[model samples]
Target: MADRNPGMDLDLEWVSGVRVNTQAVLKRAQQVQGRKVAKKEWQAAWLLKAATCIDLTTLSGDDTPSNVHRLCMKAMQPIRYDLLQSMGMHDKDITTAAVCVYPSRVADAVKSLKAANSCIPVASVATGFPAGQTPLKTRLEEVRMAVEDGATEIDIVINRTLALTGQWAGLYEEIRQFREACGDAHMKTILAVGELGTFTNVYKASLVSMMAGSDFIKTSTGKESVNATYPVAIVMVRAIRDYYRKTDHKVGFKPAGGIRTAQEALVWLVLMKVELGDQWLTPHLFRLGASSLLGDIERQIYHYVTGRYPAYHELPMA
Candidate 1:
């Protein structure tokens, strides 16, 4: 059971007046699905296009060491290392924006990729990631370890149990504490959109998280049956956009889990472009939580640059 703090004050009036004819939004989204993105939204589209090139995955899984080594090496390989040089990206362009891993592996990931020119931040999953059902002290300690291990960003899973039970105050306090525990590291709160069960719940959760001081509100942990989806992302982004309009505060959105293909990445990019405009397209404002999409983007970039696909593809599909 979760406690309800009577002191919690939420002005639901703003959300109440914002009525989205979900059917219409869905219809509009469907109409734009395969069509060419409008000229005005092209910049936003392109940012998403660049973001699609990012691969956020764990390097150490249950797989054999050789297999893990192969995956890691493949993740590091530039699709067209030479072409990137011509484009001024050098050997670093092909590298991911960041390598997300469990907290225990942050040191190795940081050390191995230190030579890379890009200051690719190491992101760690903390606070009993994907479940977040642990005691507050334990969760805070986990966050502390991630920060000490050199994590520039700490991804914490929101307390779904509290949120679902309508214990908004409890959930809010949890995030507030987690944010403090993260210190200077950016905090990304995972809403686990699928488990939240509805767009309305997703929207509410997004609002609560932003209000609670989340640097970014994320979709999933890639550990649930219902991972990131366009509709749920739309809901979260719209809520953030509305909140920004009202409070003049900027928050980011991250759609992680199950986003494996270049096409899927493109779709998300398109959604962001259409819903939140060009401002949220960069890695700072938007991110794709994927483990395998990076290679596909490299393939596409290679095809665009070389006029042919490579014969020996090393990267795996998300």
Candidate 2:
């Protein structure tokens, strides 16, 4: 694990001064998505690197212990052994960064990973996930319970009302409490960028979340109408770079939802490498949150080894 981000004091001046040029952000995002990606062996290798940073997630209402167990197994061995051996990476100990589930399923995920002797951390979404409309006491208790249930990381959703209303102090205090409730577990604060209304608001929310001690600033809860677009992500990472320059504290970034293909994953990796440099390229400072994204990544690997792509059922389902 990377060093924890012990948050700093809130600077309303810094938070309020944030301004994002929408047109400029869109142009930059286009350039990022337009860049040509590597092919053949290099593509295979970069896709494998993307696999290692995935937070293999199952956030469905119908998620069961059996499915969670299956998700855990897949996280342990994200790629087929033969596919890995074909690239001579079978012994690299490659696996998804972590297994993410709802707070109710944290125990089941922990049990499955433990029974299998896997060390991949269990992450649970708490604080009324997707919609953080719960009461303060209730949200705090939810965090504590998830931690006690063996969750090593907690993904908390910030109250968007504060951000939308420009209540910087209120937002800071709320996230600070969530950080405290996290205790030993790392906390990833979800900005739900799509709901923030404007790019400037997204940048301010990112700054405040980091000021309140969030280990990571995530793009969305994957439930929004718009999730994880490159323009929104660009604003968030720029805030991360700005924060790092000011406080010397490295905060991670996560772009969940709408990222479904190997090509999209490669684009995100490039976004991180180009915007935040090489250090943020690892799982320690970056993560991709998706349920079906891994399957396509695996399919791409299969195609790279073989001459063609395999049918959906050809690869094992998580």
Q: How close is candidate 1 to the true structure, as a TM-score?
A: 0.83
In order, candidate lDDTs are: 0.71, 0.95
- TM-score for candidate 2, residues paired by index: 0.99
- Report the error of model 1 at residue 282, Å: 1.0
Q: Which residue pairs come into collision in candidate 1?
A: none
What is the C-alpha lDDT profile of model 2 across 108-211, one tens digit per residue?
A: 99999999999999999999998999998999999999999999999999999999999999999999999999999999999998899999999999999999
**TM-score versus the correct structure, for each prediction:** 0.83, 0.99
**Per-residue alpha-carbon lDDT of candidate 1 for residues 1-318, written as tens digits (9 for 90 to 100):** 011111224555543444456786577667547656434234323533454345467634663433433434544653445646554555444555566778877776666566444466778889988788888899999999999988888889998987787677777788888888888788888999889866777887888787777888899989989998777777888888877887777788888988776667777877887889887777777788776676666666555556677555432433
**In model 2, what lDDT does residue 188 have?**
97
